[model samples]
Target chain A: MSGSLLITFDKVWKSYGQGEATVHALAGVDLAIRSGEFVAIMGPSGSGKSTAMNIIGCLDTPTAGTYSFMGIDAGRLDRNRRAMLRNLYVGFVFQGYNLLPRTTAVENVELPLIYRGAAARERHDLAMKALAEVGLVGREHHTPAELSGGQQQRVAIARAIVTRPTLLVADEPTGNLDTARTHEIMELLTRLNTELGLTIAMVTHEADVAAYAERTIRFLDGHVASDAVNLEVAQP
Target chain B: MIWETVRLSLLSVRRNVLRSFLTLLGIVIGVAAVIAMLTIGSGTTEKVKADISKLGSNLLVVRPGRPAGPGGPGGLDQATNPLGSKELAALVAHLSGARAISPASQKQVRVIFGTESLTSGVTGTDSAYLDARDWKLVSGRPFSDSEIRSGTGVCLIGETVRQQFFGAGDPEGEIIRVNRTSCKIVGLLEPKGYTGFGQDQDNVVLMPLAAYQRRIAGNRDIDSIYVAADDRTPTTELLPRVEDILRDARRIPPDREDDFSIRDMTQIADAMASATTTMTGMLGAVAGVSLLVGGIGIMNIMLVSVTERTREIGIRLAIGAHEKHILIQFLVEATVLSLLGGIIGILIGLALAGLASLTLAIPFAPSLAVILLAVGFSALIGMVFGFFPALRGARLDPIDALRHE
Candidate 1:
């Protein structure tokens, strides 16, 4: 079965600095991701996976290539328009969870909806539903400091999905958790992918975390080393 | 959307309560300085105006010779040519615009009443002196025309002199000694309070010109002439005509500088008012520098806030907040701080002005327009000074900010 293409990168090139001090963060990247796929990108530090994630999330633009997200040229859009695209279509869950301090879990989850100019009542209801989906039903008033590592990630996930974006991009979503918490977060992502048909692109260094995705892509230096379907994960 | 930004700003301010109050202290002091200076300045101006008006409206005092140095209005020893009754009569006959004219002579003399004694300014003037100087009788009656002509032993005691000589007892008709001469007190003068120069206006004794010249001065010389203009005549029109009349009466040559000088009380009032207004403006400007310093304080704190909340800004940007939103948030926060300080400062300034007015015995003249301008200026300062910090926050690269420790 096939679905609509959500992201396309054709010969994407990105670099930092200029002249002899230049460093290529991404080199001639060509990739396509469909609307309903769960993909994991694996690479060591300095492998340029983070750069690719940033480009794909519309937080940055490619220096010399075409990056089209939802048929709009991500490389050509200005900062404000790119931010607009990110607000409407892409959600990011960072390794640090990145919850605003002194803010309640409900308010944190309501951030994206707020950026999208949602009415207060609707934003509240949607945020409540999002929090409940992450199994944090009665803990909406707790601040990030009050929540455990896994619970904070759950709140972050609620925040990411409240706007109902087409793609959820997570970079090391379980990096800071214990193994048990990591497994719980993995299970939650797997359920969200399977039950809600949410497309996900996750970056991880751990093979066990990579095993949960339907497909895996490995990077070496600034280029992809391998790309293949995960037969072990597809059957499970 | 604006309401949302304001709520966020208030939340951020509430987050660091102590820091916010410290920052507001600068603005509070600045606004307080401005309001207090302006309030007191206008109050002083009102006092000066009232004191000058008490000398009477549309009035002119012709004093012999020009003032010398800082010694005040009596003139130099070399310019000691005084007027006579013949010259006074000539001015009265020639000046048609004059409603009342009086010749004045003065001497400082020790007066004795009951067992108490004090030195008082004993001024010798005609009966029209009360009309020319706008002096009112509080009790008894003024000296009759015949009493002034014959130089009778009769005098009017001012409020301060009355208090000094008679306390609360009736001083009217009581006999009091002026140096060696015993003069009966004919009337009590209404209290005129203090002059602009802080001199007591009620510390004088008034008598008919002939009586003062005969008993106090023992001379025929008149020191000054007081003239009250008609209600229909402005001092500008009345002044030159009076000068011409004086020059003709004194027989001064056309090529020579006039021996006497005419001081228009209205002109003096206007001059005093302008000087006070100028001082108020200069003080306000000096106070405004402190406001600018206060603005710089706001800018400094806002810059620090932006740096401290770098990670928070990163989170907001990553969550798809527009740069404009972040800009508005910080700007509103700074504005709210300054406006709060401005309101508090106004209240404090009002209290200070009220206390000062009471202690100084002047009117409380708080101008609403000045208060509004100060508040508006503080807000404008917030925007002007908050801009750079807000721009720095807005223009931040999300990835760099997020990675910042």
Candidate 2:
């Protein structure tokens, strides 16, 4: 059964600059992602995939048309209000594994909760649980520099889920990983999507990465080129 | 939440120890200058007040001159008539509210005892000189009234003179030659140490006015008259009376200015103390300018730090950190850094002040209020200078910042 829509974009347009030099990043893009769905966004550079992901995560607002999240017109909200929405509902994992350098893994995971005004003890416990879920229990005290690429990515994932956010926005999460590490990270993400029914919108260029998602959306020339279900992949 | 932010800032500060210390140097020197100047200034003020008090309390000095004006030579005026025994006798007889009236004239003369010879200030006055000056004798007795009237060669030697000629032996009954005349020592004057002007107060000898005029000065001109006010009288109230008595004793005409000047020691004390306070304030203000420069230094470094940590700011923002959070974090970092500099500066400053006090022979006076104000001011400087850079960091666009290398 299809779940209710958690994100919707109705002809969303994001433009840069003004007048003749203007470039449209997202041109009248329309898309919908349901709760509990793992969607992969595929496109070449400047194909509006990253722009759509930013809009979905509430990091940026559309220049025209509506971008709604859960039941709210998020594009119309102010920067601080959008920041609050993002903090409450969205988590981000970046290609660079953007955990703060020189900070312990557990401390990095507690960062989002710090902004949430969580008490120290409660934040520590939640961060510990999140780290354990990411299979980084023994490396909680290791800094990013001390951890390997895969381990650092796992810490980033722990940080992303520490707040138990409703949606996870991952941009090229496995782009820097090797073949084996990529498979391991993909399996961990798939298990999270199935067991927790967490909504995930990941941006990636690889075909195998897209196949791991339940649905794949392709963009070209600032518009959605195609959307299809991955029928060959086994359902959870 | 504040504690977490503070901890984060501390970690950031510690990450670059050398840079942090260099950034703090300006504040340290500024605070140290302020503390040292203020502490030494107050100590000098105390020394000046103490020196003035040592001259005498409730006392006035009548000198034979017009009051000195700016750029003009001070003390005795060459054109005016010198005070003599007539002025002294006039005050002793006509002036009321005066506890004692004594006249003194001084000259530097070589004194010889056996093979040892030293230059000494020889002062001539009456038996009442000790009472008027608030001076005491360590041993023996002051000159008798008969000795003062008859010009006997009896004199009292100060501690410095006794140390030079007697070498810790008893000076009483010992005869010392004063400018070719031999005088017998009757008493040992108590030690008064040195004045703030570095003038030695105990390197002299005291004798009767009659003996000094007859044997040493060979003249009856008195240099100054010492008038001490009674217990119930204020110097301000006693000043005019002495002036009137002196004018009449000299028979100064009503149309002309008086030939003598009477100075109140209490007034001079107040003026000197106020001058010292003004000097201290000026030094402190100059030091305050350095603190401003130090604050600007903080602002410059904080701006550079914000630029360097743009990506970190983006990471925090992406995870939902508010603008105020970023602003407060930088502000706290700057404050903690400046406060640490202030503490170190205080210690160094006090040590410098203590050393100065030891060398200059002034009291070591450290004021609590000044130290507290320095602490508060350094913190305020951090907040004020840190505001602009912090605002810049807080206003950065998350996407743009994240894209920064």
Candidate 3:
């Protein structure tokens, strides 16, 4: 695959509270990732991996230094502009699935398109395509409550990819699943990365989950402890 | 986008049916109360106007004394400043807009016919009295001009008097005694229900003024004069002319109040209407408070909803929903709730007003402007009260919200 930088962070700092109460969530972080690469962020609780992912997703901005997405300064965008950027370019899959309650899987997948002001017929067709991509074609009508944990996560993933975003960020997406379901979810992510050439940045504490990625960035005490490529997995 | 937001709002409302209904109840009561009060108030005004019209349009009652208690002018007593034939003649001569003028003198007398006797008022007036009071003859003719001039003992009996003395017999040509004076019944007056003053209009006998002066009243004094204005003339315009004429006829100085009073029936009708309108406004204002209460209730529920749906909002935000979209969604939901309440309240109000109007024997008059205003006002209330909560939902921090349990 051709390598082109998609996201870059230069000396980014994010701190919460003020003065003596301040806590550095992400301290002096610098990193760069290419398009179509699958990277896993590994850290202990409150080690700043989630904070970095947030800045990369444009859900947040670094308090100091510059964060850029596709050569544009993402940290300088206003709230509304940032929201538009996320709608057009970023998709998120949460650990809790976060599928809308009382809504069908297909409708949940249609959320991003709705914000994009897509016509109803097109939104429906695209949502069907997205659900089918995650092996959820026949289960579009089922609600989150009516499905198993794995199926719910699949619906969440379908919602994430419905916009055909350039980047899909997953925050411990398999944290709530059992071992078999976790393997199934990781395989789905890998397949999306390989076949669609989609850029993925995932946060997880499990070593095996990080092993599935082409590269891993481990964080310790709000700083990047290690950034290395995995040579074991053969490149296409 | 708006349609989708509406759909979402409707779905959320449906999910919490009981809470939604309870919140809307306040608005329902408010709108219903306002409509019902105004409707009933208008109906009562209509009834009063109808009652006044029954007394005949553009007619003024001239009494020697001021009309007493909450209705007419004051000062002077009837016993001392009584009117006579001269005053009647002056009214006929000096007034330009008067259609008819008739002087009346009344005396309570007992009438007997065919061994049946009933005590009733004997009113002495000429042929012009019928036109002035707008009375009609049900059977037989009114007294002839010659009969009135000659003081003939022929009289017209009202329906109540006929009922009391005739006993199903034809009393048109029968003789009856008015306190020992024999009189032939020339005609029967039409039924006139009740007067606004609660007096029965059909419980009297009408006779020629000359005959009444000679026999029933035993005096040449006329108690009052009834003046009917010309068709094109308004009573308000005719009143001042009559007052001036009376003042000149009675020889009263311009600096002093008149020795008599003129009561305009239309003015009384207008006063009653305005009073009811004020009361209706007050009632509607009181009811409007409940709409505010209902609006507050909506805000309360919406705040709780925002808190409960914090994570959902965070998910939506993370998925790329604008702040304004969330704000509009909640605003529309609140408006829908209030609008539903408003529509139902209108229906209930109409039904209640109809029932009240029927029971009170008044006309049902629902104002379309008022209904539209109420609907608009309720929608406004929803927007005003729903704003803060929707703003809170819109401005939530995505990270913190998504982390909310």
Candidate 4:
């Protein structure tokens, strides 16, 4: 049915605690995404959409069931293994655009390369290439404080792509941007997913942001309410 | 990698230069105090050792005592009071290791030379006294053995006595009088400032033993005897044997306490060395406590730094910049502060030590071990006080940290 699904979540359950204090952040969520697909997870404030994004990003583990990313069995991954998995295949972009403010745009992008112990020249070349891809080529020398909120988010995007990770995990990537900059950010993400054939999964509450993805998955309480292919996707 | 991390941390420090300098103040002062205290303490110990060694490490002092009376006729016995001419002759005859011995008497009296008059101490002994106490004549010569036996009214006056009696003039070979007796000064002794008891040693004159016994002490008995051991003998090995000889000379019965005392200069040296070591240890401890305070100051500022840069930690974490990287950055920053502080403190301490030596008229000597210990200790402080803050920064959650205001 699915051609070697890049990501597969099988009846996964994630809860906050034991007994009476257990917060059912996710309950029996099953999902699958093929290679090169762009999907958006949409939900209300109390829904488990963010939890699903965290699990997909390898920032957390599920209480029950199995998660396989790119045919790798990730359910029993240790801390080192999870870190290695995140480094090798997944890149995260937070809602707040968590770029180290003290670092310039290129240096911010160079951070993941540093973790990979890349040589200085290679790291610089890759970071600049990623920044240029996001259309921040000449602005690589500017720190986050010197950039606009949209520019900062773009730099975060540049950093996430620096290592050429297989999966791009964004949690409200354009939350702090205006409508125009939000469109610019969504356009950048769509181009990366389609043109570069990079698999992308994003979590958002904004209907307009969700419209950019080819598929939309909706959550209610702690379970998926509906999953459907977008009929009128606005992505590149 | 270390240098890169150092450079980054240094840049962070530069971002808030005033805060960084203020945070490092404690380290600087602590290091300086440690160096200063150690240098001065060592200088003091050095001065004491030099002075004590001047007493001639091989010298032994002896004094006569009354012999106990048998059922007490005149309340004295030959066994209690001895060590007279016979004991002296026996020691000089039998002990091959004995270099020389001086019989001595002391008197406090007034000295007059022409129109000059001064009250000073006078000692009566032979040539051996000069060698035993490491005394040398600055001018003229010491009294001959012929002069000592004939009770020749010749004297050797110390620097203070000469200055008092003759002012800037050469007092040696000049005639001076003690009480009512005329004596010519045959030698001028070099200055020996004071003893541990603050007694002025340079204000005395030396005369013949027989002259002092007949003219001043008015008795036949000598006050004390000073013995010098040969170069082939060591004070440590010779002391007990000499003690046994003195006990035998005094004729103390077996299993009995000897009446007279024998003082070896070696004991004085050991006691003084012990005291100085104790003082150095105490001062080092106090300086160590100040260094601890300095370390705490570093920790306090690092804690504030972590709190201030919460969002930075969050960002680094999100980028997969491992917890170890954050830990190393903060640790390196603190270590740099402490190391620089240590350097400055060492210089200041040595300067203080030099100043003390200059003012106190003692020798200034630097100690390398102390300096190295200070540097190492400061480095350790940086690590100990820096760990918790670095760990706190490393453990921050990417989500909460990114959200921190």
Q: TM-score: which candidate is best?
A: 2
Tens-digit per-residue lDDT, A1-236, candidate 4: 13458988999998888899999989989999888888999999879998888788776688998988888778678644666788778887878888876779998888888778788899899999999999997899999899999999999998899889889999999998999999999999999987788889999989889999989999999999999998999854
TM-score of each: 0.90, 0.94, 0.84, 0.78
Q: Tens digit of lDDT per residue, candidate 2, span B205-244?
A: 9999998998899999998999999999999999999999
Residue-wise C-alpha lDDT for candidate 3, range B80-156, written one tens digit per residue: 58888888999888889888898888878888876888888899999999998788998999989999899999999
Q: Each candidate's DockQ score against the native complex? A: 0.61, 0.71, 0.65, 0.32
lDDT of 1 by residue, B284-379 (tens): 899889989999999999999899989888878888888997898889989988888888888888889899999898889999998999899889
The residue ranges of model 4 lying beyond 4 angstroms of the native Cα positions read A1-4, A101-106, A135-143, A179-184, A228-236, B1-46, B64-95, B106-122, B144-221, B236-257, B278-314, B321-405
lDDT of each: 0.88, 0.91, 0.88, 0.81
Q: State the lDDT of candidate 1 residue by residue for A2-48, as single tens digits.
A: 56988999999899999999999889988989988999999999999
Off by over 4 Å in 2: A232-236, B69-79, B162-175, B184-186
Question: What ranges in model 1 sit over 4 Å off?
Answer: A228-236, B66-79, B114-117, B162-177, B180-186, B253-256
Judged by DockQ cut-offs, the docking class of candidate 4 is acceptable
lDDT of 2 by residue, A1-236 (tens): 17899999999999999999999999999899999999999999999999899889998999999999998999999878888888898999999998888889999999999999999999999999999999987999999999999999999989988888889999999999998898888888888888888899999999998888989999998999999998876333
Candidates by DockQ, descending order: 2, 3, 1, 4
In candidate 2, how many Å is residue A192 off? 2.0
Q: Ignoring the other chain, what TM-score does chain B have in each prediction?
A: 0.93, 0.94, 0.79, 0.84
State the weakest 10-residue window (summed lDDT) of model 1 chain B. Answer: B67-76
The local lDDT score (0 to 100) that residue B282 gets in candidate 4 is 91
